[model samples]
Target: MSRGDAHAAVRRRVCLSAAVAWLALEALPARSATTQDATWPEEPDPAPGRGTPADQAPIDWPEIGLLDGRRRAPQSWAGAPVLVVFWATWCPYCLRHNQRVERLFREVDPARLQVLGVAVDRDERRVRDHLRQQGLTFPNTVDDGGLRARFTERRVLPMTCLVNAQGRVSLRIPGEMSADDVRALAARALAG
Candidate 1:
């Protein structure tokens, strides 16, 4: 081969190697960020007469159906620190958080805290099957009919909101959380 041809081949090989490395890195698990400020998207001002808190207004829980077929209304979250987590079965990050949530439920006292999982899957049957296969015993809600419209409006996902006993939203974290993170958030919510 000519000298020019050899150099071009070497450059092509380098580009291919870099692309492969990037894909490999993308496949790895993500670390939990301490703050979700940088991750959550900004919300637009509400139209006239909406009369709602910007952050809390965008979360429509009632539209989502809990595992027991009951609507996940605000009343359901009353008298406990509710951790409403929006996730999907296909998302790896979401799956990882699901495992962590299950562990938290097993270790933590339910009387003091509640963890609610909202699956964004379009197919309710598939979601139910997956939940059964995984042995996820906590209350899970499925967001059908684009019930996630509010959450999507805020550009949040794998998101979690900490609701106080009064049914008021306290904190919103817009990323994956570990078991330790759940415990810490619960502790703070209970203390308050």
Candidate 2:
């Protein structure tokens, strides 16, 4: 083949190879960094005022000490729907969501529902002060990665989950929510 013709053929071959590679990458299913088979499952497009169903496997809750010097055991609130919230002090979304959660805690009976807050922040004093200032009496514990891993791998702030009376996680929400939505969580848990 002529020199120019040979060069042109090589260029075309390279372009075709690049196109094939691009197509292969584009055809692959998109994988999120937060997804894990062992962790809680997620919905493609979660509906407003609703939470997606999480893993059916029952959660093995460890004995956790509340910031208020109280200790909570699984048997203490057995056969009750438990609301577990993973939050942080600096997260603005968590701040607002926590207030609505506090209201829900007060409105619902302890026998019907149990609320537990998991603060991912290292500052125990700040978390305690924030809860105290908000007049939130719900039991909360500061996590050093141990407790958080049992629930979710997503680092999203204000992650919430509803563990049913049987200790199975029923609903898993990964972001902030409205007051009405928080109120409906109890109804959803009881309805099942």
Candidate 3:
């Protein structure tokens, strides 16, 4: 090959190699600063008018259906702290957030704190399956229209709200949060 042709070939090979490396890195589950620093969009607070439902104390657990064929009745866990996660089965961000929350859930004292994952989708089976796939055993409840409508229906999935022991919102994270944030919220929840 001519000298010019050889140099051009070497340049092409280097470009191809670089492209392959970039694709391989993208395919991996990224745990770098870019992924860690990146976060889902969030709101300072949940949607307005989600103020306590009539005859319901603000921040109290509303009646919702649990995954295990059981029901979560209001006031049953009244005095405990609830980390309410409003998520959907179809959201990839929700999947990632829940996996982290599940780790936090396992670490915390369930007796003093609770993680209530409220699935916004109508498909109960999908929610259950997703939770199972994530290996999350924390109590998950699929929101039956009324509960979700009363909460934020602004289309942002994976919203988190920390309701303290006295049935009031202490922290409102409308999108994805770090595991450290979840742990800090747990500490605040338990302190109340």
Candidate 4:
């Protein structure tokens, strides 16, 4: 074959190969940007200050309740740095943070800081039994009416909101947090 013809044949083969590769890639399904099996870091990266805006009013806790039980206000958080944690007994991450929370309650002065658990589980008996089994002494309010709607409007479990002494939400942390993160948030809230 002529040199020019040979070169042209090679170019045609290369183009066909490139087209096949592009077609194969296009035929494959696209992967989701978000991952379901993402491994969370032991120490979460520094997050932005996603706190409640100053214009947002403080959440009224008393207006919320336990399943079929009387709704009562949070007495412990009155005029103190409050940690309002929305968790459930069924969530593994939530259960893991329970011990950390208990330890924080013991270490931190209750007069200066208070952690109130808000169980978002639909079943109150399960939560109560789990808390009792875990020997958790902190005061907890049940969200039978799904009071989470009043919080950050996010439907994620194990969300924690640090409320300052001035009754303002200073930080809203979604998902599990390490003990250090909790302490840092508590210290910030107390200092503020």
lDDT of 3 by residue, 28-134 (tens): 98564313332323333444545432223465356666898888788766778788888888888788888888988888887799788888888888878888887
Error of 1 at 42 (Å): 14
Model 1 per-residue lDDT tens digits across residues 1-192 = 999999999999999999999999999987546333233343332334433333354244464467767665655556777777788888777777778788877877877888888887878888888888888878887766364454334445587766677665556676677666766776776786
TM-score of model 2 (CA atoms):
0.70
What's the lDDT for residue 147 in model 1? 44
**Candidate 4 lDDT trough over 10 residues, lowest sum:** 33-42
lDDT of 3: 0.72
Put down candidate 4 lDDT per residue, 1-192, tens digits, no spaces: 999999999999999999999999999987532212123222321333433345456766555554436555656346887888888888888887777788888888888998778898777788889988887877677776445655566666688877777776656677777676676776777787
Candidate 3 lDDT trough over 10 residues, lowest sum: 33-42
Model 2, CA-based lDDT = 0.79
- lDDT values, one for every candidate: 0.68, 0.79, 0.72, 0.70
Task: State the local distance difference test value for candidate 4.
Answer: 0.70
Per the 3 Å backbone cut-off, how many clashing residue pairs does candidate 3 have? 0
Candidate order by decreasing TM-score: 3, 2, 4, 1
Best by lDDT: 2
Please give me the total number of clashing residue pairs in predicted model 2: 0
Which residues of candidate 3, in runs, are more than 4 Å off?
Answer: 1-57
Task: Return model 3's CA RMSD, one decimal.
Answer: 5.7
What TM-score goes with each of the models? 0.65, 0.70, 0.71, 0.65
